[model samples]
Target chain A: MPITITKSTGQKELLNIEKVKHACRRAGASAQLCEVVGQEVKQQAKDGMTTKEIYEIVQGIISKEHPPVAARLNLKDAIIKLGPLGYDFEKYIARVLAAYGYNTELPPILQGACTTHEVDVLAVKDGRAAMIECKLRHEIGIFISIKDTMSTWARFLDLVDGSAIGKCPHIEECWIVTNSRFSHDSIQYGHCKNMVMLSWNHPKERPLPAWIDDKGLYPITLLPQLEHNTEKSLIDGGFVLLHDLATADPSLVAQKSNIPEETARDCVKKAQLILQA
Target chain B: MPITITKSTGQKELLNIEKVKHACRRAGASAQLCEVVGQEVKQQAKDGMTTKEIYEIVQGIISKEHPPVAARLNLKDAIIKLGPLGYDFEKYIARVLAAYGYNTELPPILQGACTTHEVDVLAVKDGRAAMIECKLRHEIGIFISIKDTMSTWARFLDLVDGSAIGKCPHIEECWIVTNSRFSHDSIQYGHCKNMVMLSWNHPKERPLPAWIDDKGLYPITLLPQLEHNTEKSLIDGGFVLLHDLATADPSLVAQKSNIPEETARDCVKKAQLILQA
Candidate 1:
């Protein structure tokens, strides 16, 4: 009998081991490791078990050999942990955009045609510019709705109108970036208006997770055994990425985060291991 | 010495007795009664007291003679009590529109050019129709932001496009109705777009509270001494307006609400007193 599993969205379906392997592979696990994790998950998953439980099983199998891939698998949860507020996520997106050769800034109150707008991230590359709206949801199963996309478009229109009248910078593109999935209507509206929407699994060819995984841009929050306070301290100290922490001197990290040198050294070692892997 | 009182937004100002008198007069208190209440508020007022404390003093003075006016004074809070969700507030707005001779309905699902919209209330009058978005905030000091107004306009545009393509209803006006105040940028945007924004104090004249006071259209939630469960039952049974409950058959109210007939009769009598006053 096929074992049934409940998805995060409360829908039930039969557990497919191929999907398990595919997810592991997407998280940067080797094909051999993916097969091993898939077999382990198939053995353990019972009827009515949640997909979250199956995910933990896969993470455990991958973690024993490849801790970095396991960390990458937990990327969605780590990103959610970045916020009860979205300011950090906005900074993270700016950094990600910078990594892709875009010079980005969190503009201070851009004046639109009708009113002022506090834009989240503005990225410029090769004489072209984009206004990015970051929609961060701390909870799972919450979609970025059409209302959000529509408002973003409206703000873009105001900016365009302002630009025509010499009030604000001209934005060539409007982008909505979210850690969660977009609603179907949001996706349709975005496509219809030619707005660039980057979410967890949108655009099929290169979604947000794919971009992070391709660049190995894992957040420091994904480090295993990280205390909440220490993680907050690292993020506050501008060490949002594991690469940042790994490249920094341990003593400086300790001084900046106000933590013991030994703890900082251990954190650095863990970050180095993850990056090296 | 001038007494200082804190406004709801945490700004402190000198207590203006004229403002208190104005508020009382706005609530339909007799000019003589307004004078009495204003004097009592001034006598009891202290430095660093909240405007809410002063409001209670006015309500106490008025309740003894005009219970209905006192209830009307609580209209803002009463509307807030209508929601943790916005559905009841939408229904209340629809009823209010109906009372003003607009044929209204909560459309099931409206198809726009790009996507489907769950419009809050659609009101039609004199061969012109409007799509009203009801924004109900449960907390005080939360202003309806520009993003909300812009999105409503975007949705309205989609509906207009849909009508041109024969996909949905043609709306002549777009209105945003809220029990809270609108942000300054929201007001600017609404005015620029010619959108009708009816909030607690927008338009300066004939605001939401003024409209409610003009026709004595108090919600049933304003009924004094109403038990929480009893209020829920009455609201669920379609007694949203005080006038509706006042004119309802007492035995029918009791049977529908599953309350004692005497309790229902007492509720009716209280409603009658408020409506008559």
Candidate 2:
């Protein structure tokens, strides 16, 4: 008999070893390591066990053998720890988009046709501009709803009208970016409106996790040696991406973040190790 | 020098005795009483006082003499006390619309063209149908924004498309009803979209307070003798409107609410007293 495991959404499904392997592979584990993790998870699988428990089991195994892979697997939770407020997440997104070759601006208050909007991230590349609305949810299992997408579309429409009347610059595309998942209705509405929707795992071709991994653009919060105060200082000092700290002088980072030079150096070293992996 | 008072929106304006008199008159006070209250408020007024403090002063003076009018004056706070959740507010709105000669239904999950929508109130009258969205705010000084209005418009559009394709009932009008005020941008977008906006003091001529006063459809939460548990029970028992409880038999009210008959009778009498005023 197959063991039924509960998902984050509270739906029950038979535990699939292949899914466990896939998650391991997605976290940059070796094929052999993936197989080992999969077999271990299958051995420990029990009826009515939660997927969160399965994740913890896998994390415990990977952290001992391959700390870099374990850090990659902790990406989603790390993103969540970035907020109770979304300001840091927005800054992180801007840095990620900057790495993607887009000249990004943080929170420009642009006048639309009817009113003004404080856009989260304005990315312009090669004569194409995109208005990105970043929604960061701290808790797990909360999906961005259709109302959020609809309002984004409405604001985009207003900006388009403003462009025609010369009130604001022309924005060719509107995007909804979130650190969480999008609800089914939100995806449906987004596609129907032709608005680019990016979340943790939507638009399966290249989701947010894939985007982060593709550029090795992990957040500074992903550093295991990072303390809460240091993390806040680093983020407040505009070192949102791990790469930002990894490349900066330790003394400069210390000066900007109000942290000890030794602590800044340690964070940068940990960030470099993960990026190198 | 004129005393400057701060509005709920945090904008400072010179104190106007005429506005105080208007508020008292609107609360169903006699003209002579309005003048008396206005004069008292003016005498006690000081620079930098908030509108809420002014309201409290007026409420205190009125409660001492005309308790019924004082109950009416307490309408906004009473409506806020109905929430922490909006379930009772939706029911209350249905009753209010019903009193206005519209056949109303509570929260029908209608299938729109793109997705399903759990509409707050669906009201039909004179062969015209309307979709009412109730936005309740428990806190003061928070205004309903354009994002809210835009999303409401988007959902209405989807329903209209559904109606055209024979998926949902035809909705000719979309209304946003809030217990608080609408932001300037919200009002602008609402008017631009031709959406009906009913807020605390919007539309200039008739607003939510006027609507409730016109039909004497105060909520059961307005009963002073009503305890928290009894209020919950009464609301759970489907007696949202004060008139519903006032007209119900004391025995029935007690049985439904799990309260003593005497308490129920006292609540009904108090409700009746306010309604009579």
Candidate 3:
């Protein structure tokens, strides 16, 4: 049975099982499991199912077999929901790095030989610092391209040169972190340069979703009940991590974010579920 | 005779004396003088004159009476010829300030409260510094809009805020110098904010052309003999001012720029003529 799925952008297209298998492989699912899930998803497919609905069904089948892989797949869509707000996304990245025992400097605008460059997040530990460039995408189809990778490398090089000239502090490592997938050439170039790149799924060495899941530092945007004006309020109040929201008093969310007490309680409940999920 | 004049981009337009008169008026030419020059230029027009040729005829007639006013008019087109090289233009601006007894720093990237910004030329004299933003345009019809003005203001504000916090050097004034004309709103906003804006014409007090002539520091691009590859080579060799080329030996120009000695000598001769003109 063939099925037409409606996308978030209101575009409808026939769902292809090959695409499903490809995404599953990219997410590191076993081929045998992918075949089984593909068959089950096709069986459950209907004419007017939304893409989100289809993804939920796929997640259900996949999670029964592999929960971590299921979480990673869902995490892609979850990160996309975190912006339009770029600074909020940067804070979220900081939270994730903090969980890994790295002290992050929020924005270090280092003077360089050629120019002054603003590094997104500077992670320091044990007298070593990594200058990081974070590229956050709110849209699903956007990819971090080779141009971005090259520019980041150039900025890193300039800062390193600046350090040689006593303009800025010395950086020991360079990293580029993004919520979206990487372009093929960018991944190849980054691998060749030994530059650490953490995207949605590339370099199987350390994909971002796995890093987040292992650290259990999910963004507050992932909470189901916290949205729109409340989300903006929370972000304005510098509340970014789900763990922080989950542990805080429900009345604090209501008072600070000006949401109803019932809604605040529901947000806390959702955040707790996400933490335990 | 109705003449067809080709623009730099190779598009042709009929030579209209009315347009000539309008240009003359905009350049602050007297009505009676504009009428006389308009008639004389029309009489001198041939079948296929270039726009540059027409401007020269207008300039020659105007210069006979008012040399500085003619230099101001000719300076606009001369500055336009300086780029596609932005860094060279910044150097040219620095040289202009140097001529006016201001100690200038090239490409100083100052850290601000919000971000790091690279100021094109920082002019300091007697314990006061002015951060300058230079906008160089290669194309003729393009005007510097209010958006550029606002962003420059924002950067200036951030740097001033940084100075308050002791992040960088204290900037006493903010100035924007552009080869092109400023938009009406940009001029109005600059006036309201007490910001110094030197464009082709708008800021009646010390406009860019007037300021350039006051310093007598003409860019080497203004030399008619220097164009194309030779212009690029001269700029690359750090020979931005015509006065420098006029003083430089032809052998040195030939060796440094790899142009023929004869061409180098011709460039120097032309530079001398421009200096005297």
User: Which candidate ranks first by TM-score, i.e. highest?
Assistant: 1
Q: Any runs in candidate 2 off by more than 4 Å, and if so which?
A: A1-15, A39-53, A98-103, A124-128, A228-240, A244-264, B1-21, B32-61, B98-103, B124-128, B227-271
C-alpha DockQ for predicted model 3: 0.03
Report the lDDT tens digits of candidate 2 across residue range A206-277.
Answer: 998888988788898888856778899999887898889889999999999999999988988888877776
Docking class of 3: incorrect
Report lDDT (CA) for all predictions: 0.89, 0.88, 0.76
Candidate 3 residue lDDT tens string, B26-122: 5566798889889998889886888889989999998797553465466566777777767777888888888888999885577766456678889
Clash pairs, model 3 backbone: none
RMSD of 2: 4.0
What tier of docking accuracy does candidate 2 attain? Answer: medium
Best by lDDT: 1
True contacts kept of each: 0.69, 0.64, 0.00
DockQ of each model vs. true complex: 0.69, 0.60, 0.03
Q: If scored against the real structure, what TM-score would every candidate get? A: 0.89, 0.84, 0.47
lDDT of 2 at A254: 90
Off by over 4 Å in 1: A227-239, A245-268, B99-101, B227-240, B244-269
| Model 3, span A184-270: residue lDDT tens | 767765665568998877658668877876666777666553457777777666667778878989898788777788887887777
**Two-chain DockQ for model 1:** 0.69
